[model samples]
Target: MSLLASGSLLAQGSESKEKEMEAAWQAAQSSAQAGPATVKLGEQATLKLPAKEVFIPQPAAGKLMHAMGNLDDERLLGLVLPTGDDDWMVVAKYEPSGYIRDDEAKDWNVDDLFKSLKEGTEAANEEREKRGISGLEIVGWVERPHYEAASHRLVWSMSAREKGQPADAPQSVNYNTYALGREGYVSLNLITARDQVDANKPVVRTLLSNLDFTEGKAYADFNASTDKVAEYGLAALIGGVAAKKLGLLAILAAFFAKFAKVIALAVAGIGYSATKWFRRKPSGSAEPK
Candidate 1:
């Protein structure tokens, strides 16, 4: 083929991919539920999402994540994006791994936890390299793991960058927050650039507070006689448990440049009205209006 024809075809292919990505973004926004709404978050919990933000519930959410280069996760309940200048995202997932004991949280030493995470991430890098994803190194904790016994909540943050990356290279942060439930835990991870994490931390915390497990699903309702317990404890959730998950969360930064335009347009004053889905709620909670 002529060089001119080959170049033209390559350009067309790139344009086609961009169009497809933009289409996915628009579809997700069209279906997104604007906040100040009560919506079901999987079978065990509800989200009282606030206004000026939108929640892209599943199926559509899963497609958008795939387009954004994230691996498929059945546990993904939905995604939250803002309608303002906060260029960040919150990924919400529900894991029915059974009750995760939090007793270990009290005994966890920050230094020990950091060591475990560093080692675990180094191991996870092997898998990333095998898949052709850039190897990442933990830059250190943005926020040390903190657990609230009374609320059954946990919060932590970490930053990572490509191995051998210059010290001045941009870092990606994952500000993770979790709400423990009788069946398992619900996690809301805020994905943003390192420089933006401090400003967006409160945003994710607000969403965490808005998540409520249905009656009988609260952590306090665990029936020790009949309920199943997770094999790992809270400490594992921070150390080994987070290593694989962090790899995926970290990769999100690499693809932001590709989809930034579409995302910016969606969040730029677009009206994302609320939409209801088939929610499974226990008897005590009020039905979606």
Candidate 2:
């Protein structure tokens, strides 16, 4: 072969090899970053690197703002939130399934769970109205199942607006809800104002792009350790046993001391009701013999 032709062929071969290597590298990085797909509620999928990472249900609003600063990427999913002026945006990463598989216990159907959530939303709206506030306006809701060879994961999402004045009409708010192990995690994001697109769009995009289907590491960082019902029940049982052995007043006093605020509120409410009842009755009226 001629010298020129040989050189050209060698260059082409080198370029092809380079391209293949790059593609392989990208695949490896993606796999490494997205560890496993299955996680229970309250579990988190963390990134390999520790650079400026923020967990869902991040500690402070200011921290979230800082983590999202100056990020510009468009391929990410934008979760919009409601604001008085314009909608705010947040990006989501994980899609979870809602199916629960328990052979001994009753299994919850995905469709039924969704129906229950819808009912809850309606009830929330009614409660708002009772508080003399405008009702909630929901934009959309998303539910998807994450599947693996052996099991499935459930995820839920909803977007809605809270009460606002007529002049300050409701805007959008995006909610991303999912279960990791047995714990639930929710990520919220606010949409940007119309005029502030330049400042907010890039942040929204970057957040979405960084989000993927890999197992999330953020869940471990923030969930409460014990289940409230189980913990409280155990405490009550122990206390009851001790009270039976000792004296009821000591046990009752301990309980009241532990839940002073709750008891105080209940007492106050009862006192107010009694006072109203007594005031409504006629002072001169005899007992209904």
Candidate 3:
């Protein structure tokens, strides 16, 4: 074949591979919510993997880490999985933090916590720079730390943009909630475009409600008499301790990009880059009717 013809064929082949990868990614996501499954979340809790939603149990979580990228987390239980049912969907992850105390919740101030997060993230950026990763700037609270003392559940989010991105650039946020048990807490991480938190919250709420603490492991069973309490309190989970892990949360972006054939379909589905999925007027929380 002529040199010109050979180049054209190579270009066509590259395009074909790209299209194939996209299709495979879509098919994997569509299969997520296909078969219902149950994953035992440690000895304390259980997750109900509803129909059509994929659930990666802890055993296979390593497979994901391999496919996605290096996630610098040690407490990772597993990802709750995302369904390709919407333009964008929230990816929830579970991490078990054994028996944290809520005592500090009373004395904690939201402003102080915010300051710590800012300080901690700014400090983390130094390390990120050393590693050649882009710095992340905290844009402020999407949802301030809200702890439900009664249920032992906490929900909070921070708006973050890649350093130096345009003000209105699409962003990423993690709306985290925890189901505190007698042993440790189970963290539910909802990762998605910062703009789609509202659209994806109902599903998040459902997932939180459905995560059940098995017998002898419910937070109510906390036997101060016999239970082992974590050294950190609820405040640390939000303020200092959390800031470190929050720095690495952006790996989800790298994860999607690395496997642009699978979860990356949100971009094509919405006619935008994967980063800009669910572009809309950003809201701190779901707008009221």
All models, RMSD in angstroms: 8.0, 29.5, 9.0
**Residue 83 displacement in candidate 1 (angstroms):** 0.4
Worst 10 residues of 1 by lDDT: 271-280
What's the candidate order when arranged by decreasing TM-score? 1, 3, 2
Q: Answer with 2 or 3, whichever has the higher TM-score.
A: 3
Q: Extract clashing residue pairs from model 1.
A: 36-50
Per-residue C-alpha lDDT of model 3 across residues 203-268, encoded as one tens digit per residue: 667778778999988988878777787655777657554444445423223222222122344322
Candidate No. with top lDDT = 1
Clashing pairs in 3: 25-262, 32-52, 32-53, 32-54, 33-52, 33-53, 34-52, 98-184, 99-183, 99-184
Worst 10 residues of 3 by lDDT: 254-263
Q: Count of backbone clashes for each model?
A: 1, 38, 10
* CA displacement after TM-score superposition, residue 83 of candidate 3 (Å): 3.2
Tell me the lDDT of model 3 at 182: 84
Question: For residues 1-289, could you state the per-residue lDDT of candidate 1 as single tens digits?
Answer: 9999999987786666555555556567567787789879988999888887888888888877665545677888998877665678888888887999998887878887787677666666675666656677888899988999999999988887778999997777778899999999998888877887898899999989888999999999999999999866786667554444444433233222222222233222222221211122324544322
TM-score of each: 0.80, 0.29, 0.70
**How displaced is residue 217 in candidate 1, in Å?**
0.7
lDDT of 2 by residue, 1-289 (tens): 9999999987786665444333322222222221122222123332221222222222222222222221222212222222122323343333231222223113334454344443444544554455444455444343222222122122233434444434354333332322222222222232433234445444443433333233433333223444211212111111232233333333222211121111112222222121122123334443211
